[model samples]
Target chain A: MPYSVVGIGTSWGGLAAMRKLLSDLPADFSLPVVVVQHRGKDSDQLLTELLQDATDLTVCEVEDKDPLMPGRVHVAPANYHILIEAGHLSLTIEEPVRFSRPSIDVMLSSAADTYGKGAIGVVLTGANEDGARGLADIVKLGGRALVQDPRTAEIPIMPDAAVKAVPSAEVLPLEALAPRLVALSHEREKAGARRAV
Target chain B: MAVPVAAVPSTGAEPDRQSFKPDLERIEIELLLEGIFRHYGFDFRAYAYASIRRRLWKRIEEEGLSSVSALQERVLHDPEMMEKLLLDLSINVTSMFRDPGFYQTFREHVVPLLRTYPFIRLWHAGCSTGEEVYSMAILLREEGLYDRSRIYATDINEVVLQRAKAGIFPLERMQEYTDNYMRAGGKRSFSEYYTAKYGGALFDQSLTKNVVFSQHNLVTDRSFSEFNVILCRNVLIYFDKTLQSKVHGLFYDSLAMFGVLGLGSKETLRFMAHEECYQQIAPPEKIFRKVR
Candidate 1:
């Protein structure tokens, strides 16, 4: 798991908000992005294609055993959770946690468990507080956390929820999220490479 | 699949959120869920609020709204938005023979009891997209019970129902699922169950010969048919205590005397209403047989 996971949690106007972060990152971005957004099991997921068109990165709906790769973004495939184990995605049809299958917490926590310090957990906009505990899990596992600016988010409860749990997360606006993710990715890469060396 | 009855915790302690304060925001969340249930007839009010909070928080920032109140307003006015939120709200992640060992135990222990009955009915409650139902069908077929059993697979979300009917998964995944299928004691080549094309594996339609896919909500819908075996793995964890009890009672009523029940690894019959009612047949697999 050289350049591993960047877990993003968002809701509300998340499609547009996420595009802001994805478009800024080059297609060659060397980390896999897995996102969990609160959505209906029936809603059309154009985000994979939309993000593909919006950004230079490879975008695709995640499959049951989709291997994690750098420069690729895996959207939790509508209602399925995107989880990582032994460096592979394992989706389950388990009951919704925090009312979502692609639960932000499940994905973040799994990423922390799988990648540990190599992971970056990012919380974006939403009306509820789903990712708070997830962000905490990431931090506890030694992964860095970044929360979207509550004032700038489409919905602020999400960021506020996360902040309440862990006040030290780097809270930034949607505009600055990609830079922060990229910087975190670069630093994690060096650490990972050094460990390998 | 019929989730095995967890040992009903005698206390059925209020959903373990004591450490985390449930502020006015929490109450508002309850209200929002209640509103959704009342207006749309999808009963999410009794679902684990922790799961709801997790998903909604992300939507809040992405939607650029400040509160659940604002989110509530939009959800009420916009059917499409509400639909989107519903997709986000209901957990739909599932696969065939997920946790193969559990299915292995079902084949070894539960299938034997089912043999005594001339005909068997198995319900996969909260079936999501029907993967487990097909998994059951495959298992029953191998055990020589497919022709005698009628499997009803139900879920609240229809979107996943269509996908479940299609039975197409990434060909890339069949390797593992096939391995799981074999490890679970498949009688034939796992590939014998499906055809591979376009980088996807299309499972056999015949395996669904006895499976009836339908829509039923675990929260709002009542148990309609009596079943010989119920596999409700991983669904009840999303429910709050009261709702879990309601569901457990439904399962208790739905099951035939000495019927079999299967649940997820993390879920159990401990401290549930039916804790003493169903004796554990296999603890590791969470398989229970009704004793009373």
Candidate 2:
């Protein structure tokens, strides 16, 4: 199946990491990328704007029931837990999990549940263990689990936890992620075409 | 609404001690919600399951329970635990002048409609600690409509209602709210609305002179009165499709002809049964006017 969705979770040094990741993706990258970056409850739209400036793709903050469209980057708003349902996103005000709203685990697990084998979950540099279990869920559901190589990460706790949770996950240097995602998307597209024929 | 459960196998080498079953958990959650509703009369049975599950787990961890079934036991036997779970289940994420565009558009478009009314009744459903309610009061005051407007702010939880009635917010948020106020087309300094003291910015009490704060559950309560405008932003995102439709019906019944309905920027009246009954007043902001 074509990789239907990409869910990214990052924190600590996420602003720079996300800037680089989003900057690397081409303008026509054919997958919806949903990001959950941990930040203060009071954090403003400056982060979304900053990331948008670095990327060629359209980046928007996720709203309740916002449709998931390919070639767009959706970032979870600072204070809401973003749930991935079929073809759309939902926001909740449930109390923070592990002291964080827009929790990585919540987003990744929901994506895994919604997209199953068609989801791609990436856990990048962060200071917490939030995404580990969620990434494991993605892998369990037969989806790709990508982790930023801990050695190269600014804050390796998150990626390391992800790798530890799902040892089979591909751990790559930050520079390799965009290309790998592109290649995977192409592979999925070709497979989809073959299925169609 | 039933969320699709992915059958994810354990890929690890270790033998599974207890097989994880998503269906079992769903059953437990359903039972828990049913029990709570029957015993305590808080209807969360129709809430979106994923978020509800997360909140229940939070309560489970806090209460030292092992699973959802255990948490249900505690909830059924203990009122305090139910209160904690009630607070958890009710989503309260809010900010002053959230989605400044909504307020800005309301000021530009809906204010004119209200200007035509000699007396206005506005209902703010699920007002949640009153951030948006206060924001509306401020906006109406600036538009010279506060005196003629009676705002009814209601939430399911009484705890949040008390906090909303206080009208005191964190002083730290004042700077951020001021930015939003200015962005939403404030005519005067945002700081003029509240005085900072005791580590809080206590808003001018006179702004709420025509405002009423009460406990009203949208899932169960009947429409108390007709309204010229109803603002229920960011609240319906927690409900399933069934409840959303039902609430839309309630809003439709409550609104007078040409009255406005403002939802969070993320919400829409599309896919709703009442979609054709209202016309989109502001496209970017989810403000609609009932035309039929």
Pick the lDDT winner.
2
Candidate 1 lDDT at A86 equals: 35
Backbone clashes in model 2, listed as residue pairs? none
For model 1, the stretches where C-alpha displacement exceeds 4 angstroms are A1-197, B1-22
Candidate 2, B22-128: lDDT as tens digits: 55777999999999999999999887766677778778998888999999888899999888888888877788888787889999999988899999999999998
The TM-score values for the models, in the order shown, are: 0.60, 0.80
- Candidate 2 global TM-score: 0.80
TM-score of chain A of each: 0.93, 0.98
**Cα RMSD for predicted model 1:** 15.6
Worst 10 residues of 2 chain B by lDDT: B7-16
True contacts kept of 2: 0.20
Candidate 2 regions exceeding 4 Å error are A1-5, A11-33, A37-62, A66-79, A86-88, A94-101, A112-120, A125-133, A136-144, A150-161, A164-168, A174-197, B1-19, B196-199
lDDT of 2 by residue, A140-195 (tens): 87778999999989999999999999999999999999999999888777865776
Candidate 1 lDDT over A75-143, as tens digits, reads 876656656543445555555776776788888876665556556799999988888888898787666
Q: Give model 2's DockQ, 2 decimals.
A: 0.24
